[model samples]
Target chain A: MLLKTTLIRLLTTAVTLFGVAVVVFVLVRVAPGNPIAMMLPPGATEADIAALEALYGFDKSLPEQFVIWLGGVLQGDFGTSITLRRPVDELVLSRLPATLELSIMALVIAVALGTAIAVIGARRRGTATEVGLDLSSGAVLSVPDFLWGLVFVLLFGVLWPVLSISGRIDPQIEVDFTSNFYTFEGLLRGRLDVVQSTLSHMLMPALALALPLAAMIAQLLKQNLKEVLLQDYTTLARVRGFSETSVILREALRNALLPTLTLVGVQFTFLIGGTVIVERIFSYEGLGNMAIDAVINRDLPLIQGIVLLFAALFIVINLLVDLSYTLLNPRLRHG
Target chain B: MTGSQTHPNTLDVMQLNIALPNGHRLLRDVSLSLRPGEVRVLVGESGAGKSMIGKAVLGILPQNLKVTEGEILLEGQHLNAMTPWTRRKTVAQSAALIPQDPLTALNPARRIGPQITDPLVRIHGWSRTKARETALALLDRVHIRDPKRVMESYPHELSGGMRQRVLIAAAFAPSPRLIVADEPTTALDVTVQKQILRLIRELQQETATAVLFVTHDMGVVAKVSQQVTVLFAGKVMEDAPTERIFTDPRHPYTRALIAATPSYADLDRPFSPVPQALIAELQDDIVRDDARHQGGAR
Candidate 1:
């Protein structure tokens, strides 16, 4: 039954992704400037524009172009980028690491900070401490991610100069992928200085990205934990001599985790969208930057590939969230 | 009420009064004494504070509602004097509460075994394996068929009766000195109610645990209680042995309550008239008493 349900969910996700792909494809196409026109220089000849259109298959009928694009997409051919003159897949892959790293770090920070604040707020419910935390988190949440990024940039990058301004690493550092600076593999090699440098560079951008998500998650978790605290089982746990912390953490928090998991899944997807602003602010070479460049240069293949990648990421995250629901709640699993 | 001399086998409540924050007394200066191995039923109307008495004994009252001039002594030790942590441990080890809503009384998300074994682990420091064994044994004792399966099931998976039985097993897990069951079988069917009541009675007899059973049903009072305390709007209007209270109730409210109770012989007849005016008067008195107590405490 679990396997069947999971399969159904996966199939639904695939259908949803297909719908997203269609919408992205049409929306990107309907937007103002033609890619061939954008690619041409000022006062270019009609022959030059025509040759570029034919080369990029823009001269074909819309439906035919869509069919050819879709077919190539199914067979893993995402076409070539007009701006970079490289395969769209290669560009997406190269940029994916930085975004992925930043997102994972931000999610970690969000989960940790959000859960701590929520748990503290819930435990100190109706107190000034709780109220203060709640208000601050709410304030943080109301501000947009871009504004938060700018604020952090001003505070840390400009005002204090505690951290460097741009990129995943300092341009002066000549670190190999084999070393422990750029990748997870490198961090495991006991190279603390490289790891420290990488973290220091990533910290501000990650915090900027995570702050809003953390505040939102804290609000979500606080509500859930408060509700869980009122459950009879919590009372029973108390009467059974379980300490306040143990009851709250082990019983109430565990039960409350389902809703928080759903929120985390949503936040993760939003993180992908928010990455555009974060990457821009930090000058990080990620998919969001690639997508922006593609949009500016009117590179259709790059845009399509980035959109598809994002849709796929969203679908996978959503699937994982659904599966986690069953894992957290045994009743759902058995039922 | 005169204090009963402390004995090895009695749970005693002296001058127990529970006042709600709204200046309404749910349990007045009500007092009762139950011998170990004895079942004492507190019979009252829906809002007569019978459940409040149970909560007070368990020291699990809702936030901000003071005990207000009360002493709960279990075998001569003051329950209210102990630190909350110590009190909770003592309660878990020597006292258990079968809350009114059995379906909700157990944790919905947790399996039955761990919930039942929680006290064993927390109070007795039993290993998980030993606790599980004890839980299974207790489930069997409660006559739960397929104890292992029931142990593995969550509260929502079980029927109302099954959940009630699971709660009963959990309550009785610690071999408590006292058990305060607040409407233990109120949510179950008539047959299941009888079975649950029977299980409580059997457990009480075997464990020599004093049971302060709270219920609105006089029939349940007759079935389980040896002594009965009749409360109307929080005050103990009538207190007597169960047979005496049933046969010849002293208080007008007690008589009216008994009259209102549907009997098997009166299947064709409607319920007897309840004097709402008299109940209202008693409730007013309870409120007035509550105000006076609050003022006195201040």
Candidate 2:
């Protein structure tokens, strides 16, 4: 049975990724602007456009072009970008690490900050502290994430200048692209300055993305933890002389957090969605910025590659969250 | 030590008055006492304040309810007068509770071994190995044939009777002087309930730990308890030795409760519910008492 379910998940992921690729390819072809117009300078002749089209094989019929593109994708070649003049795979690969770093950092912030507030509110339920946290989290949850991105940029970039808001690193420093992830590459090469610079640049964008997600997580945790606190096991913990901390953290939190995992999984989808505008606002060179540039220039190959990759990332994250259900609940695990 | 002939009253509850947040007095001047190895059953229908007595003793009462006037003395220690932390410490060392809903009473995420032996490790400062051994011994005492497998299994992996037995073992881990078993078998099947009750009674007799078994089932009270208290609308309608209460119940409420109880021997006998007139009178007294308390506060 387990093997059957495992095979089903793998099959579904592959099918869905193929569907996303087809959708992206169709949308790009149907859109108004041709890639050749955007490829050449403004006053270039029609001959120049035709030559470029022939070079990229876009002059072929749409079906033939699709088959050629599909063949390249099947063979692990994402093709070259019409706008950037580099391999689509290389461009996405360079930006993939940055996007992952930003999302991971934001998610860490969200879970940590949200859990601390949730614990405080749950412990002192009905008190002013709980009420205040609830009100504040509700307010933050209501605001759009892009506005948070703007607010954070103004506060950190203009007012305090506490950290750098944009780009992966200071341009002046000669940096090696060992892993494309500056922090990982820096640590690998024993360069503290590079790691520091990469992290400082990451802090704002990650925070901008995390604040709304954190507020969302806190609200769910508070509500669910309140109910779990009243469960018989919680009372049993107290009756057995376990400390209040032990009761809440070990017993109550596991039961309470079970319900909130669904909300956390949903919030992750929103976090991935919010990355486009957030990366643009902070001038961070992640997949979000790459996607926008591809769209503007009608770079079909680059757009197709990035969208498929995003779909794959999204599916993988959902799979992870689903697997985590077994960990958080023993009944599900044993079954 | 289990058979030591100490004074009869191991736990003393005197003049306990608990009120709701709305100033609705629930338990008015309630009191009871227990002797070592004795079982006192608090019997009442739902919402009759039967479990409230158990909650007050454990200090695990709901936040909305407060014990305004009461003293719960365990082995001459004043549980009511102590600070919350101190009361918790004193209670943990000398008392325990076996809760309702056997399925939910044990944490599902935990193995049966750590959960049963946690008090020994945390409160008694026993080593992990010692706790495991004690836990295994406890499983044997509870008639769980395969001690090693039961120890490693989660609560959901066991039957209802098995889970209740695990909880019963945990309750007696510290050899508590008093155990508040608040309808510990209410959620189980009839046969499982009988087995759980028998196990609890056998363990209580063996360890000489007093048990305040809360239940509405007379069959259960008859099987497990030495004495019984019949509560009706927050009042103790009858208190007597178990057999005597069964044979010569004096209160009208007690008579109604027994008549209302369904018996297997007599299927044609009509099960009569408590009369509305009596319930009205009890509710009226509560309203009057609530007004009086409000007036006194003013």
Candidate 3:
């Protein structure tokens, strides 16, 4: 049953990705500016622009160009970045790890902080501590992540000056990485120094992206937990002689987490998308940063590649969420 | 502790008064007792606070509700006099609850094996293997086929009857002196209810455990209890031996409740609800009693 469901999900995901690719291809072409014109110097004649357009296949009819692009895409070729003069696939792959690492760090921070606060808040529902949590979470949730990034930049980067705000790591440190996933590579290679440098640089931007998400998670989970705590099972746990802590942690938390898991999964995709603005603020060398540069230069192939990657991430994450739902809930598992 | 084994009564609840924070009473001077191997069913309508008595005894009352005045003795030990921590420990070690809504009573995310055995190993301090063995044995005693498979299954994997059986097994596993079966069969189908009640009764007799059974169903009281406490708006209107309560009920509320139950044998006898006049009278009496009590306190 599990395999059948997974296979169906994979088929749907492929269809969705293809749909996304086609739409993005048309949409980028429909934009006001031409990629070849954006690429060339203003002093260049129409002849030079025409030659570049023919070479890149932009001079062909729209349908012909789409068919040609689709063929190349089927063969793992996303064409080339019109501005960067590099393969779009290579550019996206290299930058993807950096974004993944940051997003993962932010996700870890958000879940840990969110769950702890929610447990405390829900356990003390009627108290001042719970009230304080509600108020603070409300405040945190009202601000967007990029604004938080700017605030972090001012507070930690300018005032404190304790952590790096620009780039993924300090250029001064030298390390050979087998993979672009710096943090994982650093950990596997037993090079704590590289990991430390990468983390210190990542902390503020990740936290900026994380704080709003954490508050959202806390609020929702707290609400869910309070409802679950009032359930007959939690009362039975108490009557069974389990401690209050265990009653909440053992019986209640898992039930409450089902909904929170879904919310977190949905928000994580947005958190990655949110890195576009946050990355620009931190000047972090991740996919979100590259995406901005591609957009400004009207790098059509790069834009399509990046957008497709983002859409793919969204679909895959949702698939993972569904898989985990089955793992967490027995009825789903059995069915 | 040794003397408690020979104690005449396993549970003693004296003049227990539970009230909401806003001064509205839920249980007004309610009291009952349970001898070993006996079932004392608290029967009432939905708002009659039958379950409140069971909750008060088990220390599972809502956090918002306060025990304004009461004495609950578990095996001759004054539970109210003990510190909160000690009281909780005592309650955990000596009592268990068979809850209403079997569907929600077992944690959905947990396995059946750990749900029953973890308490034994953790709270009762039994060895892990012994707890597991006892759990399996109790599961078998509940007439669940293939106890090992049932233990490995989640609550959602089983039918409502099966979940209730698992709960009965868990309750009886520890051989707790007191088991509060609060409308344990209310959520089940009619066919399943009889089996669950019989299973509970069988386990109670085998363990010689005192059970505080709460139900609104008069039929349940007749089937399960040796003694019946008929409650009206949280006040005990009748306390008598089960046979006497059925054959010669004294309280108007009790008579009305018995009349309300459908007689399966007599198709001609009409089923009637408790008369509104009797309920009004009961509420009026409670109001006067509350006023008198308030005046006395002043």
Best by DockQ: 3
Off by over 4 Å in 3: A1-7, B1-8
How far in Å is the alpha carbon of B41 misplaced in model 1?
Answer: 1.1
Residue-level lDDT tens digits of model 3 in B190-236: 99999999888887887889899999888988898899999988899
Native contacts matched by each model: 0.53, 0.75, 0.88
Residue B119, model 3, lDDT: 89
Candidate 1, residues B1-298, lDDT tens digits: the string is 3345645445778888776676555667888887777888998878878888887877778886888678987767788899988787776677778877887777667888878876687668889888888888988988889999998887778888888888888888877888888898888898889999999999889888889999999889989989999987778898899889878888888889888889898799887867889878876876777678779868
> Alpha-carbon error at A258 in model 3, in Å?
1.3
List, residue by residue over B196-297, the lDDT tens digit for candidate 2. Answer: 988998999999989999998988888999989898777777889999988999987888788788999999987778898877876787678667867876
The lDDT ranking, best first, is: 3, 2, 1
Candidate 1 vs 2: which has more lDDT: 2
List, residue by residue over A108-154, the lDDT tens digit for candidate 3.
Answer: 99999999999999888899999999999999999999999989889
- Model 1 ranges with Cα > 4 A deviation: A1-14, A37-43, A172-175, A178-183, A188-194, B1-10, B280-298
Q: Is the docking of candidate 2 incorrect, acceptable, medium or high quality?
A: medium
For residues A32-100, could you state the per-residue lDDT of candidate 2 as single tens digits?
998888768899998998889899998998889888998999999999988788999989988999898
Q: Candidates ranked by DockQ, best first?
A: 3, 2, 1
Model 3's alpha-carbon lDDT is: 0.90
